[model samples]
Structure formats: structure tokens, C-alpha cells
Target chain A: MICIKNFLTILVTFFLILSCVLTAQEGKALQEDSKNSLISGSRSLQFRISNNLTLTSFEGAMISAKKHFTSNSALRFGLGLDIRSGQEDYGAVEEDDNLFELELIAQYIYYTSPKAPVNLYLGTGPQFTYNRHVQDRNYEETGEDAAWQYDRSWTIGLLATFGVEWFAIENISFFCEYGASIGYQSRYMESTPYQGYQDQETTQFRLSSQTVDFGLSVYF
Target chain B: MSRLKKSVIAALLLVFGILTGTISGQNDMQTTQDQQPGPQLEHTWSFQAGISEYFTLRNFDMVSLSVKRHFSNKSALRLGTWINFWARETSQSEIKNWDGTNADTEIENRYYFAALSLQYITYLSSGKDVKCYLGIGPRIRFEYWKTTYESKSDALTRLGGDSGEIFAGLQSNLGAEYFFTDNISLIAEYGAILDFWGYSDLYNYKNELSSGFRFSLSPLPVNFGVSIYF
Candidate 1:
């Protein structure tokens, strides 16, 4: 029964979004009489800080290229790099770790206005991410000799986002976004020669993330 | 001939209706073309950090620090990293025999396991706003164990060992994100680790009606974070 109800809710939501898009398109058509313009472009850059710095937080840089096909329609491509560091508290054991991420994104956007200072946009795209991390202490009892070591890995996945940007000042805007992505990662550790035994360990790990972010974008 | 033809036509119609109904139901749930404002390009990037808590049979507490990045618009890619810290407390006990003889035993065990992995992710539509991503890739795991035993006769022994192994497997993640604005969104994800290569190891046990250990160290991870797009 719960599944059925959820299914129905989803169906309704999809239709609602579709209708909104259609209506927005119609509105754009009606405004065509004013001035049908094409080929408008903009570039933007932004930075973000995570709220839970103890777990994860960083400063990142991004560059976006957008092409407007119609007054209110466009497509966008983005590239970004982030460097973050934080501590992991293992209840009884704790370690500080750092990570670096680089990504490339492509998306389709539907905008509410071409000339309006504030516009709403929704987009989804494919992202390729490369991630690497290092830890200070391996969480083991036998001191540094029996401690674990860390390594880096790279993976690919899909990402989606919806948000709005408000141009509070000319060529400058504040934007907020919500998005999620799913991907996989491989992680392993090597043990040094201990006593008379050679030790080895490895495991396959999964990676996924959901986030809400706010930042300032400078457009040129 | 006429009766047989009617029956055949009726069966065909029944099958067609069922198939169409299923397809329409799925389409209705997933079709979001209506939400698209116009033919526009939209790109969003996000990063999330969270802590994971693990519970094993022995009640050892492990802390995990994880980082994730996501891009959403068309096909998506996600990258994440996690480091885990494992710990435990010492136990002491005494037992009595039928003859009134008592035996004292103290056992102390401490260990930690650190794992890292990279995965390729794909999303299966759950609804307009909810989706599940299946991730497959390789993982590296390291385990270090230390044990101390004490007897009533003042005999003490200490032993410790460490092991490292790498395996390839499937990782599954399910989650949902709610968009409050076109650029800002909140998300939650739950992930499961599935091991295939590790199943054949000597320490692997299969109690869940399978060939290998029914359960090994399957990590259940959950994360929440915020995302922004440029």
C-alpha cells in the first residue's frame, strides 16, 4: 500500500513539472513578438564552504559556459575543483583526513527569463570525478607499525541539480542549489612486514553524495 | 472459426492493456519533461561530508569520515572517499564449577579497519524526485587486531596481527534530494557494500543460505549534504 501511494505521488509530481515546463514554453512563445533573440552567452565563477567542517569542508572554484538557444532556453557546461580537509572521530579513535576532487559537468537548463535580473534554472548532467585522500593515523592498537595506510582512486557517475540565481548587482549574483550524485570507489591499504608475517587487506567501497549549497557567482 | 478468432483477439487485447498499463505507470512516475522550463543548459555541482557509525557482533564502535561530489543534469558522476576507525573495550569475567572451583579470565581485544574505494554510478528512477544509484568498483581494506589474555594463575599472553586485501564488488546506494531553489538542494543517501571476491576467503562465512559467509563486513553508510550549481 505504501509503495502504491508513493508511486501515485511521483506520477502526479512528474506531470506537474511537465505542465509547468509547457506553460513556461508557451509564455516564452507569447513574448516572441517583443524581440526574438538568440546566441546570448554568460560565464560564471563560484566558491562554497561546508557547514560541518569537522566532517568535511573546503573552498572550490568553478567555471560555467552557457548558450541561450531562445530567450528563456539554454544549455550549460561546468568544470570545478575542490580541496577539503577535516577530522573523523571514531568514538574511541580519531584521525584527520584530506581529500581533493575534480569534476566536469554538462547540463540542460530551462530559464524563466533571458533579460530578467533574477531567473530560475533546472538542469541535469553527467560528471566525471577524480578523488584522492590521506589520513594521519591508521586506527590500530599496535602503534605505527601495525597501522593501516591510505591510497587514492577515481570513478564516474551521474549528477542532477535545480536552483535559482538572483542578480543582486550587475554582473554579480547569489545562487543556491540542491543536487545529488551516485558513484563507486575502490580503496585498499598495505601493511608493513610485521614480526614474521606478511599482511595484506583490501575492500571495494561505494560513493554517493547529496548536498545543498549557496554561493556567489561573478558573471562576465 | 468465428469463436476461436474472437478468443484470440480478446487475449491479445488483454496482454496489450497490461503492458501499456505498466509502461504508462512507469512513465507517469518518471516523466519530468513538464518540469523543464525551456530548452536550457543547467549544470550543478555538490560536495557532502558525513560521519558513519558501524556496529559488529562484538559491539565495537567504528567512526567513518566520508566525502562525496556530484554533478546533476543528464547522466551523473559521483566520487567519494571514507576512512574508518575501529575500537573496543576490555572484558573481564569469572566462572564457577560444580565442585565450587572458580576460574577467572580476562580478554582484551582492540582493532581498526580502514577502507577506501572508487565507484561508477547509475541512477534508476524511483519517482520525480527520488532515485537510486547502483555503484560498482574496487575497494581496499586493512585490518589490525591486538588481543591480550590473562588467567587466574598470573599467566599473560599478548598477540597482534594485521592484514590488507583488495576486492572488486558492487555498491548500491538509494537516496532522495529536495530542491528548494534552482541552485540549492538538500539530499540524503543510504549505501550498501556487496563483496564477491572476499566471499571466497578463508575467513568468509556464509550463514544466509549462500555459498560464502552469509555476512561479512558489509558497511551501511548514510550521508546528508547540500549542493550548488554554477
Candidate 2:
């Protein structure tokens, strides 16, 4: 836990410095008309750093890329991984108990204005997810240690978002979006945690979004 | 022909017609990977990456990526590399007392591999819109595998170990590719893989076939990718 805090503190501090640098472009060559004229027919690539960095205690990074299809439209894709651990019981002999979640998203975006200093866009797309929980336990009374796990799920659902972006400079922008996602999971499974042991299974519906995401984009 | 036979023949014809339309519509361009975004007619260069899932049950998987520079429609020089990582954890239960209660034992194993290959690729039929490339070359790989076992029953026991092996061998394959656009293509290839059994001397597992060479088919033939020409 201490490690996770320190990591986040350092990352936030680093981004603070980067934000200061990007903000210093206020008096630079960026004009309101420059923003609009560049939006139509021109192509740009974007790099983003987002919420996944501090979203969980497990500690992971989320990065996204967007390729402009036209001045007012683009596509964004992102993937994030979290590998968190817990000794479900401190008394258990085996220590590396873990839960894993992987999230993937592809979104389509359309902007309201092609040539504006600020742009409003509506985005929607499909989100894919895989989550699993596992642990190992030792029964001292029976002189045996067994590995067990409950509920692994793979799910897909539609996600929609509405957002605004301020092109702080000619090629860099900061944006935030409010989104919701709900989807069905094909299987919810439980087993002994052995590589191939199967025990129980069920169907499920997954509500797996945080409702809001804010990030920065640098395009070239 | 009888009415039933005529209906059956018509259904078969419809299926074949749909198949042909789909295939031609998605002509997945496989021209020279070097076909740059220009008016030039040369199909000379390509870059490809592939994902493999042939051994999921064995807890193993791999990714393969490659690039080729074609000198002519018939031949080219290629460089490719791929990485693989596999891990498995399982257990054994001891029913020593023949009771419903038990002691559980566990084992965990992990391995990673990276390979580098260089080869000369030759086209047997380099048609303008469709083609197949055949290649054979020397390949080398770096492998690291590790295993750990833990038992916490009557007598708490924990054990762990690892092994590393470097590999060298020859690989050959035949693949067909089609170009659908100026800069995109879909390709499928399959053929003999490297001689993995040659390492029998290190593990002492293949003494029966020491005097004879062994061959195995490459596991994937359905890898798709985009090509950029320069």
C-alpha cells in the first residue's frame, strides 16, 4: 500500500510539471482560427494518459491513441491491465494470491465544430473486459494447502460518452468525458484454481465503468 | 431431374455464388510489402505481425512479427521476430487417510521465449494481384523456463527452480497473400517449423530418435496484418 501511494505521488508530480509546460504556450502561435482551419481534412495522431494510472490500488498505467479520420472525427483505442494481490487470510501459507482485470475499448468520435478553439464531441463504442479472482489456502488441521478461485468473467458492452476539449495550443488538448456502460458476461466460472480444473459456471450482467474519464492528448 | 434434386442443386449454386462474391470483394491485397502510397506499380515491401493460440490447453502462446524487402516479384530478404510467455499453476490432493478431509499440494511454472530469424523468401507464383511466398532460413531463439512447487501439509515444504536454453535451427514455410487496397493485405501461411527435438541431447528425452531428424508442422496459418509500401 505504501508503494502504491508513493508511485501515484511521483506520477502526479511529474504530470504537474508537464501541465505547466503545456500551459506556457498561452502566448504562443495558437489562434482561435488556427484551431478551426486545421480540423477539416487534416490528419493528426494523439497520445493520451488517463484515469487507469490511479484508478486501482494494484498500480497500472492506461494509455490511449487516437487517429483522426477527418477534421471533425476520429477513433480512439485503449487497453489497461491491473494485477492486484491479497492474502485473503494472513494465516494462509501461500502468499501470492491475486485478482486480474483487463479492460479494452474502441470509441468513435464526432466533433460539433471543425475549426474552433474548443470542441464538443459525442463518442460511443464497445468495451471489452476480463476479470478473474484467485487465492491459495493452507488447512493446518488437515495438513494440506489448496488453491481455489471464484468467478472469472469475460464481458462486452456498449459505452457512450459526451465531452469537451480545449486545444490549449495548436497540437495539444485536454479533455474530459462522462460515460456509462452496461453489458452481459457470457460466463461466470468457479474452480479449484488448478490450470484446468472446472467446477461451477453461471451467466452474468456486468456494469464496469467509472462514469467519468479525463485525459490529455498530444497530436502530431 | 426430380424436384428435390433440382432444389438441392439450386441451393448449392447459391452458396458457391455468395462465397465467390465475398472472396472477391475483400481481395485483401498481398502485393509487395514495399508498395508505397504513390502512383508506382511496384509491390516491393511489407510488414506483418501475428498472434498465435495453438497451445492454450498447454498454457502456452506466442506472437510473431516480420518485415520483408522484395528485390523482385520472385524473391526478397526478410527479417522477423516474435516473443512468447507461458505460465501454469496446478495442484495435487493427498487422500492419505482415505477421509473426506485433505491436504493440498501446488505447482507453478513459467517460461518466456524470443526468437530472431533471417530468411530469403521466394515467390512460386507472383501474379499481379495474388501471390505466395516460400521461405527457408536459419533461426535462433532465447528461452527461459522456471518451475516452483509448494507443499504446506504435514511438513511445510517449498521448492523452486529454473532452466534456460538457446536454440538454433532451420525453418521453412509457404504463405499466400492478397492485396485489397494500396496499403493493406491479408496473408495465411503454414509449413514446417524449427527442429525443436534437436535439443533432446540437453534433456535426454529423445534418445530413440538421436540418429534421425524430426519435423513438425508450424501451428498457425491464419495471421492477418496491414502492409506499408515505400
**TM-score of every prediction relative to native:** 0.29, 0.34
Candidate 1 lDDT over B1-230, as tens digits, reads: 55545554555565567557765875775465545542111344444433222211111112243333444443355554445555665555444544455556665556565665655555443223223344555555555454455556333323333333334445555444434455554444444455533221121121111111222224342344454543
A40-118, model 1: which lDDT tens digit per residue?
5543333332343211111212344455666466666655454545444332344555666676667676766645545
DockQ of 2: 0.01
Number of clashing residue pairs, candidate 2: 23
- Highest-scoring model, lDDT: 2
| Model 1 spans with C-alpha error above 4 angstroms | A1-39, A49-101, A112-118, A132-150, A193-209, B1-230
Q: Would you list the C-alpha lDDT of every candidate in the order shown?
A: 0.47, 0.56
TM-score of chain A of each: 0.49, 0.59
Instruction: Identify the candidate with maximal DockQ.
Output: 1
Q: Can you give the DockQ of every candidate in the order shown?
A: 0.02, 0.01
